[model samples]
Target: MPKTQCTDGVVGAILASWRYDISGISPEMRRDYEQHLAECARCSARQRFHRSLDGALAVLTSLSALFFLFALSVLKHIKPLEHMAFKILGLDIYDMYHMLISAGVAGLCFSLIALALVLMATPAPSYLSGIAVERARLIEARLPERIRSIRLR
Candidate 1:
């Protein structure tokens, strides 16, 4: 909240809090240390570490939730999927050509995206010109009227 660079005492406090929460102190002037952290820089770093950890944990939880939901949905549709593929199409249940196709498609997509990024960039002009575009334009503008007329013609 206070944008000013915090002191070392504050940093100690943040670290103390993390250590206390994880391992803990013998006697409870943990309160005093916490107060000191509120004033110091060391503790602020600890707070940032804690916040980053919490963020990562939250992300992990979200991803796991998504995975489980997808798995559940897949389970629900499994019978219909198998019947559609194996029964109707007469493909072997053990065959995994779909995986290869998906992998190929992913590779192609990544390559195409890379190619697009490469193509979208402005290529550096030839070094022999030895001048920037604006300077070149100015020089071209200052050329003889006869030369300009010839160019126009």
Candidate 2:
């Protein structure tokens, strides 16, 4: 039963939402908003709005669960690392066939994730993706120190 500072019109609207009035509320002067809404259509719209806001908040809670389900769907297979690497990169590295797939697959997955993140963050011409790819490669090359420096910044 907090004191409402708004004009009577707004107070009536809040009362109208819950179908209540100012005469016999708690502590003799406070108003229950829900009780007021039940008595008024205008206030009922506000009530519905509050419900919708709650629904929107629930959506954010479910988003992380959806992401978890999607990732589980994508990478749950317990396959050999080499096979996983090739599958991830779509590479035909026959020479690396005998090597362990773990490192290559991980690298490919990391690159793909970085690409996805960069794509999402940097909105620009399509050429930017290619440039990012090249830049990521150059950073990995003889300029390792430069890459480390950039990372610090």
Candidate 3:
């Protein structure tokens, strides 16, 4: 497929330098870029791709943290892990357990830090929240009139 070009080269170049993220800009500054994005197919698609990438980073870091937490919980509660460490691996159970616990805790901390960085440095939070708001509006629009009236009250 042929590559699509931006309708306005100057604004598109500016947006590209910012990775098409206009969320950090003041409203007055954002208006022109927003308008360009709305009008330009290429830039709009690029913006969408960048936002989705940010959202994916946030989700992966979150899942990594959760998995690390789950690993720590399993190590703490599962007796078989202790047995495997002692009998199968021929390792000191207490030492092995502590080592595994330390690794899990470190991994959890690292992932949490990554998640915090992603949330702070990208437009993921606002983009995801906008998606949620859109979804909520769509769902609310579809609700029965009686339920909608009840919700309003």
Top candidate on lDDT is 3
Clashing pairs in 1: 7-41, 9-40, 10-40, 10-43, 11-40, 11-41, 11-42, 11-43, 12-43, 14-43
Structure candidate 3, residue pairs in collision: none
Name the lDDT of candidate 1: 0.52
Over 3-97, each residue of candidate 2 has an lDDT whose tens digit, in order, gives 43333477775555443323235654453554445555555554455444444444443454455445444444534345667778876665444
TM-score of each: 0.37, 0.33, 0.92
Q: Give the TM-score of candidate 3.
A: 0.92
How many Å off is the CA of 94 in candidate 1? Answer: 7.0
Ten contiguous residues minimizing lDDT sum, candidate 2: 119-128
Error of 3 at 29 (Å): 1.5
* Cα lDDT tens digits for candidate 3, 1-153: 128988999998999899899888899988988899999999999999999999999999999999999999998788854475479768877778899999999999999999999999999999989999999999999999999999999
In terms of lDDT, which candidate is stronger, 1 or 2?
A: 1
Candidate 2: C-alpha lDDT? 0.50
As for TM-score, the candidate ahead, 1 or 2, is 1
Q: What lDDT does candidate 1 reach at residue 138?
A: 96
> Model 2, residue 36: displacement in angstroms?
2.4
